[model samples]
Target chain A: MGKKTNLVGEIIQDPKVKPLSPHLQVYRPQITSVLSITHRMTGVVLSVGSLGLASWIIAGAFGEQVFSVAQLIISYWISQLLLFAWTLCLFYHLLNGIRHLFWDAGKGLEISQVTWSGWFVVSSACVLNIIFWLIAYGFFAKLV
Target chain B: MAREGVSHWWYQRLTAVALAPLTLWFVWSTIQLMGVDLAGFRAWLSGPVNLVLSTLFVCTLFYHMKLGIQVIIEDYVHDHVLNSLGLIATNIVSVVFCVLTVVSIFVIVFGS
Candidate 1:
């Protein structure tokens, strides 16, 4: 028989076959690109953020004097900088998480929609961060 | 077993939904806690409802953390040895973080 339909023959390579879809290697960088990776990075950041919060709680459980020691460190300029960065990460992650929910609901898949949403996410994170710090400073002014 | 992948995926969304409102509440609460000391912090947490919410927050957040980390490691680390070590370490870190925080909260609420 000239069938030539053995299992081994069926498994033979077709090197001529093109990949069905584009991958990371083919894409050019864009707002969506940055936003995409930042989303993952923020997830990592928020995990550390959880640890930071828990550590703060644990420090408080150590009594006032001990808590004050940690507080002293946090009061320093560098710690303030880190806290700001952490805050940005938290807000970015939060906003991006919502963006992801929208994507899950099958919205924003078109190129134009994705780009607009990407910029929206970026601006929202930055604006929200500034507002947060503004309110913090405003509160501090009142505390004086 | 019902598909491992589906359960993992399901938990991700479930925890995400749980986190949404909790995160907003947390941000609000933290801002309000500004300049507050240990006593104030303890007092806020001492409420039964707070105790329950905080526990849920910590548990779900860390569980989600572990799942996220697991997927990242599995995807990026091709080396078998390193891949496994990364996963084990992440698990330990998540477990330890939750355990310590929860225990600390308990101690604050009710000393041994």
Candidate 2:
């Protein structure tokens, strides 16, 4: 019993054993929490997606042959799908990020405003992605 | 430590503000570039305004990326040594990519 008590004491004294703030699992997801986490997730996605952007520029640097190959690769269906998703992530990140800036500026702290803005961000992102891609593929491609 | 934290937050927001418009411009430009040949694309970027804005966008982007990833690493990585290593790696990756992008753009714009 004494040893068990000492073990408990040791565990209590451990810095890492301190109680953590309730994490994601502890809370039912709400729009605020959901959008907050999505912001971070999409930020990470954009970081990775920048690789495609980097590759395109690098290919351009290497001259016509490399640039053509890069263009061909990007034209593939799989690449198009990834590009579409990347743009979605981009628009979401952009709009939500602006919301964050407004919050930082001490506006939109009300829960209703937060929820409304969250929905707006999500919807706008989708619409913008579709419109952006349609014009790129449909309208601009034809002009080219 | 407090000052450093504030500076990090400040720069993150600063870059975000810069990126908002730059992103829109980039998206518009990408749409305009659609189905253009390499020469045509190169010629577009070769424009002085496009060159400057694209360079600024690339630089701001990777710096922001590094800062954001550092925050994630700080949040998730518990080990002191590992967290530092993660930050260093993030910095290295961001710098390398940023340099590669800027240099590539210069080459595309100016190279024969």
Q: Top model by lDDT, which number?
A: 2
lDDT of 1 by residue, A1-144 (tens): 354455767644456866677687778888988888888888888788778778987887788887777777777889778878888887888888888888889998899998888888888988888888877667556767
Full-model lDDT, candidate 1: 0.83
The model with the greatest TM-score is 2
Ten-residue region with minimum lDDT total, candidate 1 chain A: A4-13
Query: In order, what DockQ does each candidate have?
Result: 0.55, 0.75
**What TM-score does model 1 score on chain A?**
0.76
- lDDT tens digits by residue: candidate 2, A1-144: 333336446523455567678775889889999998899999999999897789888989888899999989989999999999999999999999999999999999998999999999999999999889889778666878
- Tell me the lDDT of model 2 at A57: 87
**Interface RMSD of the candidates, in order:** 1.2, 0.9
- Model 1 B-chain TM: 0.93
- The DockQ value obtained for model 1 is 0.55
